[model samples]
Target chain A: MIEKKYRDLIDKLIQKSLMKKVSWNKSSRETEYYVHFKKGSFTVDNWVNDSSVYVDFTLRNANGIEIVSQTFEKESNPEEFNYLFKLYKAAEESYIKVDETISSIINELDEEDTVGKDEEDVLPF
Target chain B: MKRFRDPVFALIVYGIGLIIISFGYYFIPNDLKNIVNYISITGTFSSVYGILVAYAQIMSVRETAENTKLKIEKSNKRVMKILSVSDLSKAIKIIPEIQNYLSADKDESALMRLKDLKGILLNLKFIKDIEELTSDEKFVDALNELSIHSANLSKAMMGTKTGLNKSKIISDLDNIENQLNEFEGYLKYGNYD
Candidate 1:
């Protein structure tokens, strides 16, 4: 049984999922989820369907673009809700990780833009 | 008989006065009659002047009150507009949206989200009531800085999503947090620093 607090958390996450463009699906045959994020030099795609949960992303470097795809197949378990819960949790983690990485790039670039510049000269607004 | 109630008795005094005055043309010589005539004409003119002055004073006071009411109504309308939307709340809500796109390594989306924030800031700017609420200029400065950083962030990540400078990304993230914090602080509280 999901605790009331946990229920609230899931409901909140569900709302957030909607806002973040994460898709959730439940049909008679299968359940599915998807999250797509494109960040610096990388485009990440995560999918959780009936058969398996998979992550496919592209990484770009000097050599060339590298596409990485991994599928985590569903394993029989006593808990029916286990995979559903885990996929959502993983999506949340990935979402946060991707944000952190992009934030880093933006912050680093911001510093470069400000280096050796007088505070007064930055913006005349 | 004083003739307090009866019109006949009342007219008796006036008639007697009139008779005296009429006879006074002969009784009160020409010089005295001229003096009486001067006083009567002066009284008439004085009463008219007094009435006109009182009327003028009332009009002047009413005009001043009308002007004051108009100014107050204008100021109140401005205040109402500013309070219509919770600027602080709107600005605060945008932080997570920005962070979400950034985390997704989605600079494009992040930049777009910044546009939303920019709209919010611009809206705040349009309403002049903010000046009365807070005195610090840093609030506006912080908003402007966030806009620039957001734009630069998307532009830098535009062409090649693969060749991202890790160090640059790190610094950019820190910069974003700092600016966001500054803006949030200014909105939530009046603290500039």
Candidate 2:
């Protein structure tokens, strides 16, 4: 089983992500989670073996191109793992900001459509 | 005290007090006749005040009920406005295709897809509610950026290859998809509902 802290982090990330998918690797003894966004996507792999807990952070571009991939173990590289987490959060925020703007654009365009329509054409029927 | 605040209960209590007063009126001595009259006058004023309070309470309750009903109707209308639009899932599907084209360096194809997206946005029905959203500064600025970047990219695709901002256009489209998803989420599970 994955450690409690790692599991909680994975859950939080998955919750924040727009389109998320989760899976388990029986042979590898790891849990994999995928969060897909329009700008990019990221995958988190959590593994707990006999000695230490391992987490892999893989960041992908819009076209599923692997831009950054790194693995960190809890016992050794706590600072590096924290940095990876920070990157993940930054990416999530970027996606959120972009999404807000695009939504506004679409809404504006729709508003124009409504304005262009004559009053007579707007009947509920 | 709580029961006294209830108009019907207060009226019943007052009615019983009047009956008791009428029954005890004859028991008063002749020497205190003036005092009895004074007490009766005070009681009358108190009764009148009670009635006035009860009327005010009734009117207040009625006003609150009307306001709540108006609020509900307004919210329902807002929900209907969002639901009445054309299928936004179409835009969701088109966004990925546009991204694929952009990633593949097919600028011509990406431009066509962007036009298609614009067409879809412009053809959505019952979108008058969107006017309120346009007032937000961040949203307005973002829309403007997307428009400017899109125009620039379109020009480059046409002929002017001097400032081909492909990355910027891709980023803009990405942001659009994110915003579209957010809008869909609000429509599906908004706090207003």
Candidate 3:
């Protein structure tokens, strides 16, 4: 059994999953989760009926082309939860990492702009 | 009060009186002159002592007024900074939402919320700056503690899921929320206990 804390994390993941652009095939009764990033997106395709839960974690390029896909069955697979949790976390970290990187770049560019302003104050001679 | 408060004026008056007494010495009868001399000498000493005591009292009152003014100014600054509790309360309200976004894998939204939080913290930097400038050690230390916790929260928010300690994040959030609540209470009721 996942701890209450991990369960809560899972619950939150589900909430976000509900928000992302999802693709549903009525004939197959399959729902796909698409979480977008700057360079790529993570997609979770979940197929569920009364008896079993099947899940897939797919990495897609910026254009939504699938680059990789891993499928797991709930009854047959215990490692699915671990992988799901990892991807959820990786998605979070990558967001922060990308933001921090962009912020630093902006800061550097600002510093350079300030330097340019200072240089403008000096005579060419 | 004005006459006695001026030491220079008091001294000038004493000098003129002494000169008058000296001039009157030659006019007095020989037998009464000695008695007049004694009275003049005693009266001069008493007048000088009175003037010195009055000057000391004036100086002390001025010093006390200056000290009171300084204390009032310092407390006024403290009250001004404390008044910013409202801003802090608003900032505290954003933490939970940031956590929600981060958990749901909404990186851009979470980052946006984090940026908002960072801006709020930066706005409150003036309070820290004032506390440091005034050498209000107790308040400066408290503000420093807040800054450290805020940095930790930002780090945890940006940290990876595998490495993330949800409990720690929750605790830190609790600590920050509790602190802001305390600040608000203190501001409202003027009670620190």
Provide TM-scores for the models: 0.36, 0.37, 0.34
> What residue pairs are clashing in model 3?
none
For B1-193, candidate 1 gives per-residue lDDT tens digits of 2222345554564456555555645665566667567567455655664565556556767777899999998778656543524665566566676666666777777777767765665565545555433223444433434433443355356531123333343343455445545544554565321
Worst 10 residues of 1 chain B by lDDT: B160-169
TM-scores of the first chain across all predictions? Answer: 0.25, 0.41, 0.39
lDDT of 3 by residue, B1-193 (tens): 4455567877786677677767766787788768767687658766876777677769878877899998997787667656566677777798788678656856566557656765664455556423332233323333332332233344345541112333443454556566656655655566431
Q: Residues A40-85, candidate 1, lDDT per residue (tens digit)?
A: 1222333444445443322232111233322333354324245335
List, residue by residue over A50-108, the lDDT tens digit for candidate 3: 55665555544432334565566677775765556444444444434555677887888
Q: Return the top candidate by TM-score.
A: 2
Residue A66 lDDT (model 3): 48
lDDT tens string, model 2, B48-105? 8578767777787777789999999788777764553334567778888977887898
Assess candidate 2 and give its lDDT: 0.56
All DockQ scores = 0.01, 0.01, 0.01
Go through the candidates in order and give each one's C-alpha lDDT.
0.47, 0.56, 0.53
Model 1: CA > 4 A from native:
A1-125, B1-67, B70-74, B77-81, B129-137, B160-193
Report lDDT (Cα) of residue B121, candidate 1.
Answer: 57
